[model samples]
Target: MRKFIQSIMLLALSAQLFAQSSDWVYATMTHESALSLQSSHPSGIVILATEGNVSAVQIQHQLAPSLKSGNLHGPGYIYRTDAQDAVQALTKNAPKKFNILDFTITEDMFVNEVLGMVSQENLGNTILELENYGSRFHTTSSGRQAALDLKEKWQEMAQAANREDITVELFQHQLTQQRSVILTIPGTEVPNEIVVIGGHLDSGDWSLQTNAPGADDNASGIATMTETLRILLAKNFHPKRTVQIMAYAAEEIGLVGSNEIATQYNNQNKNVVAMAQFDMTNYNGSSVDVGLINDAQFTSSELNLFWVELMEHYNSTGEHRITYGTTACGYGCSDHVSWTENGYLASFPFESSFGEHNPFVHSEEDTFAAMNNDASHSVKFVKLALEFVIEIAKVSTMSTQELNKTDIQIVVQNRDLIYQFNSSNKSLNSMAIYDSSARNVLSKNQLNASGRISLQGIPSGYYIAVFKDNQGKSHSKKFLLK
Candidate 1:
């Protein structure tokens, strides 16, 4: 009897192992790519069906690492159930044509106000808070908590801004335990036309355990979007087009969250005018300050040009100026691909060039301290996001007339910086200067009627001059220090 009981236990264990090993997931990729994957991992992958250039494939769960590495089919593959489902998803996911509008920078005063409100301290704090999580893996409890926490934070922001109409909700996924967070600010005018900005919230590592910090891989991107949200809410920005900020889940594993959301929007015929993605924004791994993904197959060229033109108009001259270059991220590199694949105009501005992205990503070492504990690099992307949303969404009721009325100007003469304020109702209480990284380098409390300050020791670069008035309102102007 004892021998028979032991044999039964052993057989049960073996059955369980077999079940786990046989677990497979359906995905969509190019026909050639699917064939190549199957050839490379003969027993691990199987081609299910083919429709033109695309093919439905079934991959063993154990071979996910091999699929993720080597950029086999890009950073992610759209998860599906069977060949029929994958084919339907592909057929309905046709790209849409976009009516490219003028990418000009028209809201200078409002844009400047929002850009100046971007705080590196806030960004750093958010990144650190996110890193505190053990690991935001899609199937982990911490991952779901992260999404819930973000939802609460966004709700608090909306309440603080007194925009009670703003709605924040969790977009649950069927495949993953983690949920995506969405915060929407309804437009006063064209509510149907939507503008989206997003980044992944889930982090990952090789072991799929609870050690991945992903501070730069995606925490920085989320932090950037958070800061952007804070400033927009603080200013009570009313836009003509609806603005939605999303924190996607399961991006590290097959871009699952964003793909579902984008597909739903596409099927519902949501008019998403523009979508922007911020990923790995904290690391400056390249010479260029900003690298705009130029993959024509997955990104909109017209939208990319609009970003360049917008930067040149608003951030090109002073310390706020950022250098941009074109780089390509292969198929399904990030969540932007979800929008692009669904026929939406999407763009992704990265921290570095394609090959130069932060090497620490998808590892335990990707921490805030690893990037020198600095949020300066992420600040540039925050400014870019602000520029993109403000210009594309088109402010509706937010008035810059008060700012226009206050004639504040800064002129550089030799080594002295001169400020001229003509508004009689607003008295300049204090003045300060900040560098391109938003670091406060010079500050002065006592203001004389002369309105002159010396910049003898300050370095030559782009700097912003900020003036605080008696009413506690701050005004800023960008100037070149030489």
Candidate 2:
């Protein structure tokens, strides 16, 4: 009878695991009736343990409808859970002893993405910044001067190197008193719909005195975009959407510079598809995996699908764990927030476990060697990031497209507002519009798949409409009338 009971338990366990549902009870172990109560059976490593009891029960019974929902405790546990049937069968006749032991569980784990430029050839060019960064990471005239130097070098290359394909512009923001370097790769067919990738070029020491090289802080991100540009240029991949890459100024001063551009796009209602922040992508050895710190406002099913699929991809391809960090809509610790808060699928990726903790950061020693490590871990981080970009920047259905206020008049009879877009590409799937003043007016409903949106019943005012293409790209336009 005892042997029969054990067999029945095994069968029940198998059924529960196959379903992988949290709607029923699932127990790890119980003193009263675990088949192995008498002797130990091989099980997953005990990352979570009980203090005094030889055995403990992890009963996962449903509570009130409002208590909570999903996976035993969500994706935060290490071991696989037992099938619900197994829990039910064992608990059916178990005494009170089975329900009383103290227990614990492990916290969620995830993989990290290395975001900076670290390719071998680019690595050769980037390492020069480590040796030549003038030994300081301040927003000094020296720093701005360094930025100027980059512009000059690239300008010379764009002309003499016969590389006019890459146009680099320096924008000195009048409002924020900061500098912005915008790089554009105009689309061959769809030149208006835009796809933008950005990183803050500013680096800083927390003390604001010492010269922190900020190699990993952002040089990594800058390098990645630059190298990514080089790769795309070499491949001659003509995206249906125009691509814009930016190196923002004053990021260390609390993302002020990026905020200027983000807010600019926000105000104009520029068509923006997906904006990504590639900060601190190199030199982390911690086991913690990549972080997808996304704001909650987007709640777009498409955005949610991207994150879920991205993490699932990492779990299958690598050994690290990946997870979502926060739940609130207005919470994020990186430059992506500027885009996220304005209704874009903005996000930042981090590799280190304690996100805001960098011991050598903001110091002269925050050089390439500090985070540009070549450990096995580093290799995975680099590969994961590179692959992620390759996948993300490959939107193909329609290039970003933006229409002028005149175009808006032709489409809608409201005749009450003016529309303007940074660029409206000739393609279909992606686009964005910035309403420098009326950004919050667009989320009328779930416009996730609304190809041709209507703005009826809306108060007459200037507005920007940003259309993000379905195929991983975006475009924007401004509107005005009456």
Candidate 3:
């Protein structure tokens, strides 16, 4: 009788998973029960997990009203997974590896050139158009149309620049009607390395058919990225590593769109150097101009530090000084969390402190006109995003090439690294071999007196040979292993 009951339970679970639809909701009595849903259903992804009572609006946006109205409240979890096979694969249940790159920005000239191109006028226009769409709720027709419009605008901008290397694509999420917009500019040298800057295009309120202009909530982020793209094209800046600008869909709906995309990238083993999220950038809610989310559990601190230093370097004139501070936005607060959950280095440069986030979000009141119709605050993020891409991706220029031109010659033969540097004892202190993903594969200290070092059993791919001389200065050269 016990064996028969077990079989019956298993059969019931299968039925629940396979029969899930858009409107279906799985309300678990306990946290353990909620996790079981992930294993059973294809789209059995968690949308909410609160210890205390949650707002009626929050429940209405993520859970079925009928179920919540029936008093199915939870200290457990709420899942909206119906048909999300791809998303399921990307979800990491435990801690994972974060791929870190070793590139540094030493070019002040290049940084200045990019910062000059940010335009408040252009950002203002982009925000105006997005707000005109009324609402961008994931399941609504208006949301779908906004995504399509964004894709076209990005494609046209790339075309006008005559950049054949840039490709604009729409990543479809089958569970929802809207698709994510991705603009990829392949690296001139290291095409495998990637840097991502993104914002959600979809916005929402309690009423799906009503207005949710979302000017500060996210249209600001999208417009900032768009203006950043325009500046990159105008300057003809081609980076050594690929840079992608993404406008995610359904971010307001539990980060649904970005989670799917990040999962796919992880499954493909793509080497993403860093990802920056710009959500709610227009409103100057806090005294500080920029808020770097210090969510240690959800963001990369190393990258956050880099943002601070970069802003400091540009703030010498005081006019562009971005008064900034750090604060946490909790887990899964924005789309950047999606990438962080997938073991990627992601950072969120939020607009204000969490407590001070625009109260107009997720409402019809979220319009540019409502924020006093100013783009100055949002422009700071636009400049930062632009610099973040160029610096992290590292544009290929004559100066960079010249810096790598040294007497040290490196060659690879028979899966071994051959190097020759004069006066290895006093001049050279240590040598290290790093893979394209910036993982240190091998290290050696105190070179031989002959000044010739040969390493064996190296894998076939592009590698960076970094040598630190007595002066404490490091120089890196890229070599291919056949």
Each prediction's TM-score versus the true structure: 0.76, 0.50, 0.70
Q: Could you give me the TM-score of model 3 versus the true structure?
A: 0.70
* lDDT, residue 90, model 2: 32
lDDT (tens digit, per residue) of candidate 1 on 327-412: 86544578888898889999988888887878777678889999999999999999999888887887887554443453576789
Q: Model 2 scores what on Cα lDDT? A: 0.45
lDDT of 1 at 321: 76
Candidate order by lDDT, highest to lowest? 1, 3, 2
lDDT of 3 by residue, 202-275 (tens): 87733444677788778999999999898888988888889999998877655778878887898888888899
Most TM-score-accurate candidate = 1
**lDDT per model vs. reference:** 0.77, 0.45, 0.69
Model 1 regions more than 4 Å off? 1-23, 30-36, 49-53, 61-74, 93-97, 102-104, 398-482
lDDT value, residue 47 of candidate 1: 64
Instruction: Give the per-residue Cα lDDT of candidate 2 at 209.
Output: 32
